[model samples]
Target: MMRPHRGLDPGSVWAQRLRQLEQRLRTKEERIVVLETENALLHLKLAEYQGLAGRSTNEVLQLYAAHGQQMKLQRSSAVTQLHGAIKRLKQDLKSLRSFALELSKDFQRQSKTCLYQVLAAVQGIQLQNEAMQMFQIKAFDLEQCLQEVTERYEKEKQKRKALHNNLIELRGNIRVHCRIRPLLPFDDSAGHSVSQDRRRNFSEKVAYAADDETVLVKCSRPGHASVNKTFQFERVYNDLESQDAVFADVAPLLTSLLDGYNVCIMAYGQTGSGKTYTMLGPQFDGNLAFSIEEESELGIIPRATQEVFRLISEKPPGSYWVEVSVVEVYNNEIFDLLAKDSYGKVFGIKRDVVTTREGKSDVPLLTHETVENASEFLHLVNKGLQLRVTHPTLVHAHSSRSHLVVTLTITTVVFGDNFGTSWEDEQTSQRLNKEASCTFPQKMRDSKSTSSSRASSPVQLEATEKMKQVKTRLQLVDLAGSECVGMSGVTGAALRETSFINRSLSALADVLGAIAEQRSHVPYRNSKLTHLLQDSVGGDAKLLVMLCISPGQKYLTESLQSLGFGTRARQVQRGQVKKKTFPVPSKGK
Candidate 1:
């Protein structure tokens, strides 16, 4: 009733408008509540995502820290090991450097001694003053005097004679020979440029020659053939047949030495020749391919063993034995190739002890032992090869940096007094009728005979006593290749090595020259190599020299020099005496 009368009441109309405003306000409140609820839900979801993201970030940081720690630990450990290895390597280098220095000093000393000795040979130079006599007249007189001295020296020495006499199969002795061949084209070929293509072609030719030689060696039997008897048989070598032949001819003698005689076989050559191939061979391609363990590839040492066994097989057991000693001369120093001491250092051979009259004690003093077969000898030979030092050069692919010496010692013993005497053991007692009454030193030493009858049995007793201690030594030497300084392209250490090599070779040449001219004072102690080879050259051991030559034209000069050395070597004369003792075997006894 009041609303119907609102036209008259202003307060009633205002109240109605207020009620309409209240209804609209209620709608807006509802909208605001909905929006607040949605905002609260969104805030809760954001809080949950933030918590997960914070956890993930913490985990990643922890992982990075662990990884960094691990990397740091690894780096520390690697540094430790590297330091240790470097320290060890540095020590080894230091030792090697010291050794090199010592060798250099020794070489210089030897050179000085050689120079003095050579100068001593011409003593008359000091006698004539430069102003007193004509230089030409003095020279002529000196030359004439030298010639007279030479003639007298040649005529005076009947005691020392080179025993090249090969033992006949029945005599049980050894023979030594030298075989020289024509030069090769690549022997002296050197330089880095491709212009040295000729070397390649020659190498191919050598390879072809090696193949052919292999065929020849393969055709022969192990013990019966010469090829199998001498070479290393490891590799088929090109143009080494002459060496093989030399070995074959010496097999019987080597057997005798093993049976109780001393023998020495050496291969001498300039770089690029077949010395290595002749001695070492390629790798079991020749006679080595054919046989069993006992008779496998008759290399020089193996063949010698077989021959020794053959001789021993015919002899009474326990009557004969053999041993070997191996050594190397590196830059004039002696290194025991067969020594088991890994910590040992190589030492120089003293010049005083290594003289011609007094051999080197450091050259490996061999002890006597018993060897049963060829396999044992091969084992020792292989050991020596392992101990030898080899390097590569422009002249030689596998150049021997040292002088390798393999000495075999043979000892014979008669344990029982009841040994049967036959024609083989009987002494030929031919007496000198002219000197029948003279008492020789041998006769004086024999107590079995009376002083009155001592002269009658002198020859037989001396021969018998000589036969009692039938000991022999065999030497197999592989000398480092001699190379020219210019051709070798040497520098620094290499240069020093070349100089040493040249000086040593020159000393050797001087010694040979003295021997060829029959000089009274032969400078055998001038170089370590000569001193070490005293027994082989001037002592009891038989000497066999193989002068290897390169067929290449480039090597003509070296080849000629090698041949000249061979000629001089052949002219050298030596004495015959029984070996003092048996060489110790490289293998552990």
Candidate 2:
């Protein structure tokens, strides 16, 4: 079509077509460059994204593997714990069921047993109630019978006491009791070697207790036949006798002391023969420190003191007053053992014995301790004993160098039925008026005469009612141990003491010998020992001499001398000791 029109139009159309092709080609080339640059940037970004994605993928895979292993371990542990919990629950359930079954069984058994016990207890209680009623009835009847018997027994006891007292009075008041001490270890060992040959030839047993009241001594001479001598006494205690047995025999004497009678108990013997032991018990062994509960071990002094207080307690209060004095005759001088200075220091003060108008001996300036009970009395006694002069010797370990005398003075006042009037009332008033008149004659003469006349009048008869007072003394004498110089082996001061002791003892023996022989004069002034004991020896006081002896053959001479002394003492008969009773004037009569 263009070929027909063809000429210049064809050429223009062709040129236009060529320009358009070039423009299109250029536009395509610019798009291709932009696309290529974008493609290169996208390739770099994809490479960075691939690298980051590769690292994240590796981290995620590792996390998943570790999480899977952790989950597996947790599941295994949970399974194991669950299995153990189930096993424990099963065991606990079985134990609970068994315990419940056993508890039911125990409850059933206990209920049945309780029912039976309750029934038995009810029956037993009922039986006991009936038995108690019967016992009450029997007890009433027994009490009535006992009341009647006690009345009769009391009447019989009074009669018996009267007869017993009469019997004791009939027995010689000056009674001698002999006691033989047991052979000690020292006694056995003393002359063992020297007497070995003598032991073979001569019998060690020289003295024998013939009976309860007699001692038989046989002389052991090598060339001569044995001469057996028997001595009788009021009571004789063998070596085997205990302190209680000896005290029992002397118990009645204490009763006489409470009956208002003056009593003297003295122990005399050779050294180491138990003279002190008989009166005050053994020394150097704490015998003096014994308690009151140890009654069986108490000696005469303690027992007598306790008994006196017991008897006083039986009486009404304010009826009796007891006073005690402890003194020792050392080196022929009387010393108050309980005497002390204001500073509580014991002083060796000398004492003098004076004879009262009533014929009783009184030591002037003596310490008179007022005691209420046995303990206080014993305390005073211990104070004196501690101050007692004692020294050791070859024969006796604890030898008393003095004579100890413990005196208990009891003043008892008995009230009469008539009150506000006493025998002493008129007498005391008369004496007072008389004394006043003598002092001031002009003023008191008329008053004294009127008072005397009134006192003698019948209106004053009721006022003259008698008030009896009983004053008694109990003397416990612990004589110093008599020793031979050769046997004692003493020297210096001890030897001098021994000589004084022997002389005093000899003087005592002389006095007793004179009394036994019924001499005109008893020679009580021969020594202080005899002079101090004048009333107890020859007066109305009852005297009991305890002659202690050693049973060993080595002490044959001393034992014989002691037996002879006891024999003489027994023969010295004293008058029946009457209880001291006198009318005491009431105060402000």
Q: Number of the top candidate by lDDT?
A: 2
lDDT of each: 0.52, 0.70
Question: If candidate 1 were superposed on the true structure by all CA atoms, what would the RMSD be?
Answer: 41.3
Clashing pairs in 2: 424-585
**Model 1 misplaced stretches (Cα beyond 4 Å):** 1-189, 194-244, 255-261, 284-298, 342-370, 414-468, 575-589
Candidate 1 lDDT, tens digit per residue, 535-554? 55655655667666665545
Model 1 score (lDDT): 0.52
Top candidate (TM-score): 2
